[model samples]
Target: MPDFPFDAETHRRRRERFLQETGGGVAIFCALPELVKSRDTEIRYRPDSDLFYLTGFTEPGTVAVLTPHDEEHGFTLFVRPRNPEREVWDGPRAGPEGARERFGATAAYPIAELDERLKGLLEPADAIFYTLGSDAAMDRRVTELLRGFRLTRPRSGKGPADVRDPSIILDRMRTIKEPGELDQIRASAAIAARAHAAAMRMARPGIGEWELEARVESTFRASGPTAGTAFPTIVGSGTNATVLHYVDNARRTEDGDLVLIDAGAALGLYCSDITRTFPVSGRFTPAQREVYEVVLAAEEAAIAAIKPGAPFTDIHEAARRVLVQGMIDFGLVTGTVDEVIEAKAHQRFFMHQTSHFLGLDVHDVGAYATADGSPVPLEPGMVLTVEPGLYIPAADDVPERFRGIGIRIEDDIIVTPDGHEVITRAVPVNPDEVEALVGTEQAHTETQRHGGEG
Candidate 1:
C-alpha cells in the first residue's frame, strides 16, 4: 500500500473540529468490519472512507470515541490487540499501543473493553453522536449502552440526555478539500489518466471489451502500485455505452463503433474519475465525430462554469444547453431548442447529468449551501467531475443514420478562486486530439506488443 496520505496531526484536527461542532458529545465511529467469503476466507479489507479520513488508520474493526473529558486532552481509540500467530498468517496490525502512539489517541484500549468503557465515556456527556444502524452489531452495542444509560438514575444536575449522529457535522467538513487532500486526488487523477490512455492505445476493432479492461487495469498498476480503479471500469463498446454503468465487458469491438470508457483510480482513498469515448478503428466516422464534438463542447462549457461561488447547477444546465441544441441542429429532433429544453427532449439521446462532487468517495459529501441553509456556494478546495454525454440507441427515433452511438467526455476538476483547475487535463478532450492520441503513435507501439492492436 502507498504511504499514508493523511498526517496524524490532520486526523487529530479533524476529530477536534468534530468535537467542537458537536459541543460536548461522545461521538463513536467504527472502522468497517471485514466480511467472510466463506467459513474462514475473508474478502479483501477496505476501511470505510470516513473512518480513514478521520483516523488515517486502515485496520478493520477498530473503533474510536471522542468524549468531553478527552476534549481537553484527546480522543480514545479502541483497537484489536496484536497476536503473533495472526500476524504470521496475515500481516502486522496497529494494536492498542500502536494506535495510541501512532494515531495520537489520548487513551487506547482493547476493542473487547468497548462495552465496559463506553458507559464511562457517555455518562457525563450531553449527546452520543454516532452513525445510526450502519453496523447491526455495533448498533446493538450502542443500543445496549443507551438502554443501560436510560435505566441509570440521573444525577441531580448532571446526566446525558440525547443521542445524535455526528455525521451531520463531519459531512460538512468533508465537502471541502484540504491542500493535502487535493494533492492526493491529483495523484489519483494522474493514475486514472494513464489508465484511460492505455485503454485508448490498445483499442481495436476485434478486441473484446475485457481486453480494454486489462489495458485499463494494467495502466493503473504501471502508474504506481496504488489502490486499484476507484470503481469498476465501464469498458462498453458501441451500443453498450448507452447502458450507463456497463461493466460486463463481454462485447467485441467492431468497425465504426465508439468505446465509452468511464473509469478512475483511487489512491489513499482519494479518487480521480474520468471518461473518454473513442473510435475502435482509431478514427471517428463523420456521424460519430459530429455527436462526439457536441458532447465535447458541453464538457468544455460545463468546465468553464466551475468557478468558486458559482452554483454547480449552473454548470449542469450549461452543458445541457449545448446538447439540447445539437439534437435540433442534427435533425435528430424537430423542435425549438427552448421547447426541447423544457420538454427534456435531450433525455432521449442524453440522459445523465453533467457533473457530481468528487473526492474521498467518487461522490464525496460536502455542504452545497450557505450558512442560512441554501445551496452551498462553491469554494476553493472543492473537486467535482464534469461529464457530458450523448447516447443514441438504435431505436425508431426519427433517424436511422443517427442510431446506436454513445459519446461522453469527463474530467476531474477543482474549483479555483478565479476559475477551476482541470485536474485530469492530461487526458485530452478535443475530438481531434483524441483521434490523434488514439489514432496511431506510442500507444500502438506498446499495445501491439500485447496483441491488443489489430
Candidate 2:
C-alpha cells in the first residue's frame, strides 16, 4: 500500500533469487481468498505472504506462474478481469493489461483462462512447485487441473511429473533479512514501540482494556494511513493475563492489576511483535515486583544469548533456567533448579517457549532446526522475538501473595555479526523506568494539547 517500501527492481531481484534457489522449477502461487466476516460483510483481505513476497500483487483471484530463467514469458499472471459492474461495487482491479504494464508480467490473462493456460505452462516443466490444501476450492481446482494434465500427457509427453511446495526455497530465503526487509521491520518496530509507550502512559486504574487496545492501534494508524496492526492487540488484565492468548478486552482493570499488552504493527508488509506488562496503579505491589523481577531477569538473559552462531535453543535455555530458579527461590517449587527443570516443575508457571521467528507473519516461518532436528545456528540478519513470561495462578499450591499474577517481557531482536540489536527498546523494560513511566505523562500531554495552561 504505501508504494511498497521496495522498488519493482527489488521485487524482480527477489523473484530471480527464488528462481535460482528452486533450480528452475515451475511454480504457481495464489493470492489468499477473501473471507466472509458476517452473512454478507467481508473481512479485510491480506495477500498471501508467499505470493506478495514474489509478485507484490495484492489482489484476490490472482495467480502467478513462474518459470525460472525463461525471461520472455518467464513471469506470467492470471488475474480477475476488470468489470465496470464489479468496479462500482468493490474497487477497481488491475486487469490483465495493467498486470502486464505495471507489474512486469510477461504474459497476462483473465483468471478464468488459468485452467486453459496452465497446461501450456506446465507442458515444458518436469517438476512443479505449488502449495496444496491451503484453500479448499483452489485445491479442488488444482487437483482437477493435474488430472487433466495427466490425461493429456501422451499429447505433450513433457508434462509436469513432480510437485513440491515452493516454500522449500522461499522459507530459507526469508530466513535471512535483506537490507530492505530489515528496514521495513525496523520501521514497524519503531512505530510499535511508540504505541506501547503511549499505552503505558495512558494506563491507570479503572481503564478499559479495550481503550488501551484502541490507543495502541491508533498510534500505529496515526503513524500513517498504511501503517497498521500485525495482529489483534492483546490487552489482558489481572488474572486474565495468566491466559496465554487472552484477547477478550472486555474487563475493566482494577487498582493493583497488571495489564499485559502483546501487540505489534504492520508497516510496509513487515511486522513487529512486542509485549509489556504495566501496573494499573502505576506501581507494582511487592509480590508483583518480586515475580516481575524474575521474569525480567529471564528476558534479559535470553536476549543476551542472541548472537551470531548461537544455537536457537540457547535463548530458551537461558530464560528457562532463571525462571526455574525463581520458582525455587519463591518457594513455589521445592527442588533445586536443575532438579525442577528436569521434572518440568517450571511449566506450571512458564509454559510457552521463549522465542519465535518474527517477520511478515507474526509467528513467521523459517525452520528453527535442521533436517535431523538440531537447533539452527543464528546468523547475521536473522530476526526473532525474545519473550520470557511467568504466570502464577491463584491455587492452593501457589504462595498467596504471588498468586493471580502474570508478567511477560518481550523485545524484537536482529542478529548482527557481532551480536544482536534490540529494536523495541524504545519502550522501557527496566522495572524502575516502567514504574516511573506509567500514568505520569498523560496529564502533561493533555495540558499541552489544551494550549499549555499551567
Candidate 3:
C-alpha cells in the first residue's frame, strides 16, 4: 500500500542498527495473526509495528530472521506460500520468490519450513532476541525448537545460552523521529487538523454526537484513500465530556454546551493525536470561558517548555503550576498553589498527565525516565503531545456554573534544536478564532435557505 513509503534499503539500515545493538545474536520477528470478528468475517489486518519497522512487510503468517555476522545470508524471510485457490479469496501474496527479489531477503522459505530452517539458524547463535510472551503459539514453537537444539548440542557443540527482548533496542530507536517518519507524521497531523476544523464548524445545538463523529471520519477518508483514523474518535457533548474515555456518542448537543473532540488520523502508518474543545452554540458561556482559558494557558506553558535539553518533567510542571493557580483563582479550590500541588488536590479537576509520546502508535513507545528514575532530557528528534484538561463534575464541592464542564486543548509538538515546532497549528485554538470558525455554520445555513441568493 502506497509503495510502503520507504525502500528496502531503509529497512535494511534499521535492521543493521538493531543488529549492532543486539550484538552477536539471532533476532526473530513474527507478524501478528489475523483475528476473526464473527463466525466467518475477519476484521481488517494490520501488521505488527515492530515487524513492519524492520522488514516493511505487511503480510500475516510471515517471520523474519536476522543474523548479524552472516556475510552471505544475514536476512532470511519465511512467508506463506502462494496458492491459486487462496489467491481468489484473499489477495495475492509476495511468495518466497518475490520476497527474495523484491524485499532483498538473502533467502526465503515457505511458512511450513520455518521449524526446519530454525535448526540451522539457531545452532551457532549464543543468544536469541525475541519478544517473549507476545504469542503463546510462537512461544511454544520457539521453546520446542530450543529444546531440540539442546538435544543436538553434544553433537554440534552450540546452542543459544541467553534470550533477550528486542524491545530494549527497538523502543529507544522509535523514540527519535527520522526524516522519513517526520514526513508521514506531518501529513497525518495536517489531515487530522482539517478534520477537527470541519467538526468545529459543523457543531451546533441539536446535532447528535455521532453526526460529528461521522463528519470527522468522512473528512479523514476524503483526504486520501490510505488515510484512516488512528483510534476510535471521541466526540463527547455536555455532561458526557466529563467521562475521560467516552466513546458512546449517543448524546445530542444542547444549548450552552461544550463538545470535546479527541481524534487523529493515520497516514502511511504514522499517527497523529489531537484534542480540541469548542462551544456547541458558537459562543462560550462565561463559566465555560473561565475554565477554557485556564486549560489553554496550561497547554501554552507546557509547549513553551518543550525545547531540547529540557527535562521532560519540566513541561508537566509548567502546565501543572498554571492549572493549580487557575483553580485557586477561580475559587474552585481553597489553598496556595504549592500546597495544592503538593497535596495533589488539583487532581479533582485535572487528573491525566500533560503530555505523552506520539508516533506510529498514539501512546508511542519511549522511556520517559532513565534507569536511575530521573526524568529524561528532551531531544531534538522527539515528538510529543501537550494536552491539559479540566473536567469538573456536578458535586457540592464544585461551583454551580462550573459543573459539568470539560475542556482540553492538545497539540503535537516536535522538539527542535533551539525550540519546538507545532505541527498541528493548522487548527485554531484561540477562543475568538474558535468562535469565528464555528459561526460559519450559521452563515452557510442562511445562504442555503435563500437558495444562494446572497
lDDT of each: 0.82, 0.88, 0.89
lDDT tens digits, residue span 307-425, model 1? 88788688888999999899998888778878998887778888877878888889778655567766666789889998988888888855677788888889999988888898897
Model 1: per-residue Cα lDDT at residue 332: 80
Ranking by lDDT: 3, 2, 1
lDDT, candidate 3, 219-251, per-residue tens: 998888668888999999998888888999999
List where candidate 1 sits over 4 angstroms from the true fold.
37-40, 71-73, 153-159, 369-374, 439-454
Candidate 3 segments whose C-alpha is farther than 4 A from its true place: 148-155, 451-454
Write one digit per residue (lDDT tens) for candidate 2, span 241-329.
99889889999999999999999999877899999998988899998999899999999999999999999999999999999989898
User: For model 3, how big is the CA root-mean-square deviation?
Assistant: 1.5
Please give the range of 10 consecutive residues that has the lowest summed lDDT in model 3.
1-10
Taking all chains together, each candidate's TM-score versus the true structure is: 0.93, 0.96, 0.97
lDDT against true structure, model 2: 0.88
Sequence-dependent TM-score of model 2: 0.96
Model 2: CA > 4 A from native: 148-156, 445-454
Worst 10 residues of 1 by lDDT: 151-160
RMSD of each: 3.0, 2.0, 1.5
Better of 1 and 2 by TM-score: 2
lDDT of 1 at 67: 83
